[model samples]
Target: MSTTTPPTHPQRAGLHRILIVGGGAGGLELATRLANTVGRRGLSEVTLVDRYPTHFWKPLLHEAASGHRDPASHHIEYAALARRHGFHFVQGELEALDRSECLATVGPILDLNGNDVLPRRLLRYDSLVLAVGSVTNFFNVPGAERYALPLENVKHAEEFRQKLLTACIRANHLREAGAALPEPTVNINVIGAGATGVELSAALRNAINLLSTYRLNSLEPERDVRVRLIEGGPRILPALDQRVSAQTHARLAGLHVDVLTATPVSEVRADSIVTVTGTELASDITVWAAGVAGPPLLKALDGVELNRQGQVLVDKTLQTLSDPRIFAFGDCAACPSSIVGVFLPPRAQVAHQQAVYLSQSFLRRLTGKRVDRFTFRDAGTVVSLGRAGALYQGDFGLGLRSLIVGGRAASGLYAFVYRRHLFALAGLTRMAIETVSQWLRARIRPSIKLH
Candidate 1:
C-alpha cells in the first residue's frame, strides 16, 4: 500500500502535462505524434500509461492465434517507442481517478511470484485522455468465462495457438498408438461471425493444412480437423455490405469451414457447446469473439457518462460530457458520427482517424487556434479470408454507391491497412527497413510456428 510519487523533469517545469491512459492503437499513435511535435520543442510534457509492456496491432491477433504470424516479431516495446518518440512511458493498470485533483492512481506492479515490484503511484495531469480499449463480453452465457478463450490481446492469442497445437499433437499421438475413440476428430468452435471470428476460422484452415503438409500431425486436416463458425445473426459480417458478406461466406464455405448462422450458443462446456435450439456441438476448443465492452475501469471513473456497453460518452470533439479537460476515443469511447447521426463503429480505422484528429486538435489548442469537430468519413470495409482471399466493399465516391472487389486485389488492399499503420508509427525510412527485413526473414523462417 506504499505511495510512490512520479519523477519530475526540471526542464519541463511549468509545461502542461498531457497524460494518456491506455497504449492501444489510438493512444500510442497520439502519444507519438504529440511527442514528436509538442514534447520535442518542450511545449508540453506527454506521458503514456499502459498495463502491457509491448503492443501488437489488434487486427493481427487472429493471425497470431492461427500461428501464421508470431506476435513477438510484430510487437514493439513501449519503453523503446517512448524513447524514440521523446515521450514518457508508465507501465501500470489504472486503479482510480480523482477528477477534481486531476490525478490518476495506478495500481502496484507485482512479479510472477506475487512479490511487490513497484508500489502504487499517482500521476498528475492538466489534460487527460482515455483510450483504454474494450474487453470480451460473454453476455453472461453459462460456463463461457470458465471454458472459452477470448482473443482480445496477444496473450490470449498465444494461449489459443498453444492449445490448438496441443490438441492436434495429442490427437495424432493417439492415432499412432492405434487407439479408437468415439469421436476421432479435433473440433474447434468459434463463436460470433464478425471480422475476428471469420478471419480466425479462415486462418485456422490454412494452419491445419500446413500442419498436415509438413507431416507434423497424423490426422488428416481436411477430414479430421473441424472448424465451426457460429453466428447468432442471419448472416456473417452483418455490418458490411450484403454483397461483401455473401462473397466472404462463399469463400469460407469453399475452405470447408462450417458456418452455422441463426444459431445462438446458450452455454459452453469443457468439451462441447450447447445451442439455443437444443443441439449439442463437439468443441475441443472454444473461442469467443462475439462482442466487446469497455474495460471495467471506465465504469469506475466518477462523473464520466457511460453507454450501455460501458463505453465513455463523448461529444463530437471527443471530449467527455462530464469534464472538458478529459477526452476519450478509440473502442472505449462512444463518439457520435455527427454526419450520419450514429455512434462510430469500433474498428481500427476509426481509432486511427481519431488519433490523427486528436493530434491536430492538440496542436491547434497550443497555438490558440480554433479546434474543429471530428467528422468520420466512410472508407469502406475489408475482411481477410486467409489463403482464399479477401472481400472489399466501400463507396469509392462521396456518395452511397456501393463498390465490391474480391480475390488478390482485395487482399492487397486489406494488407495495405496494416502497412499504413506501420508507416504512421515509424517514418518512411524505418518503415522501409522494416518491410525489407520482414521480406528477408520470411525467406529463411518457416511459414507457421510449430511450437
Candidate 2:
C-alpha cells in the first residue's frame, strides 16, 4: 500500500468543475450527458468520480450473484465511457466534503494487485452532484455483518456468486463422500422480499436446475435445495401495486421457493437466520437483500440535509434541501415523486429519468436560462421469477389502463428492461457484441461453477 499527499484537479478560475461522486445509473448518465454539452462547450468541465473504475448496472447485480449472468460480459469501463462522452473519470471513495470551502476530499485508490494507485484527493467544484447509491441495511442484527453477504455492487455480487456455487458443490461432495455437513439441506435464507431478494431466490433455484442438467446430475431433486425468501413486510414487492405483488407471489410459489412473509429476521448466525417467530432458518448461504440505506459518508457531508434513512433530500429541482450548489438523485438522494406523494422510490428507471431531466436542467443553467423542476412519470413495474415466470404492470400507451402480464410474457418483458438500458448505453452494435460474448461463455463455462 502507498500513501501520498492530497491530489486535486485544478479548476479554471471562472469555469466550474461539474464533479459527480457516484457512477451508478443516474450519476453516470448525468455526467456523460453534461460532458457532451457543457464539458465540450468549455462552459464547464464534467468529472465522474466513483469508488470503482467500472460500472455495472445495479439491477443486474442480482443475476450476476446467482450465476445467471456474468459481470465481465456486461460492465462499462468508466474511463472509456468518460473519454467517449467527453468527461474525466476519477476512481476514489467519498471521504468528506468541506462545503464551506467548496472542496471535497476523496478516499485513496488501491489496485487489486497490491499497489497504491492514488492517494486522498481534494477536489474543488463550483457545482457538485452526489449520485452515490444505497447499501443493504442489516438493521443492526447480530452476526449479520459477520455472516450474511450483501449484493451492493458488481464486486459484492461477483463474490456472492462464488459463495452460492461453493455451497452447492460442498453439499454434493459431502453427500457423496458420506460425511454429513452441518446443514445438509444446502439451505439458503434470502432476507427481504424486495425485487432483488424475490428475483434471486428464483434465480438460485433455476441455477440449481441447470447445474443438475449439465454438471451435477447426482443432485437430481432441487426441492432438496431449500430456498426461503424471508421478508419483514406483509408481502413481497411491497413497493409495487397490490395486483403486481399478488402476481409475483403466485409465480414464486410455482417455482417451489419458500415464500415467508411477515417474518422478520432477528439475527444471522454462522449457518442460519433466527426469525422473530423463534424458528431458526437453517441456511448454509445467508444473503441480505433487505432494505437499503445511504452510505455513511453521505451522512457526514458537512451539514447536508438527509432523511432518517440517511439519503440526501432534494427538492423538485434536484438541488439538495440545504445546499444551493449541490444536486442529488438516485438511491442516495430522495427526490419528490408526485405519484407516491413523497420521495420517489430509488429505481434504475427513476434514476435514469431524473438524469435526463437534470442534464437538460443543468444545460439550461450553463446557458443562463431558467431550469425546470423534475416530474417523474410512473412507468409501472415488472419483476421476473427466473424460469418459473414473471410479473408485469404498466400502461402500453394511448392513455389506456396499463395492462399487467405475467408468466412467460412478463418474464420476457422483465428481461427487456435491462436490455433497453444496455441499448441506450452501448447502442445496438455493442449490445450485439455482449450477446455473442455471453453465448460463448455459456458454452465453455460449467452450467454452474460447482464451487
The lDDT per prediction is 0.89, 0.82
Candidate 1 local lDDT, 160-265, one digit each (tens): 9999999888877877888884453899999999999999999999998887777555677766789999999999999988887888888898999999999999
Judging by lDDT against the true structure, name the best candidate: 1
CA lDDT for candidate 1: 0.89
Tell me the spans in candidate 1 whose CA falls farther than 4 Å from its real position.
Answer: 6-11, 182-184, 339-341, 396-400
RMSD of 1: 1.5
lDDT of 2 by residue, 354-382 (tens): 88898888889989999887988767688
TM-score of each: 0.97, 0.92
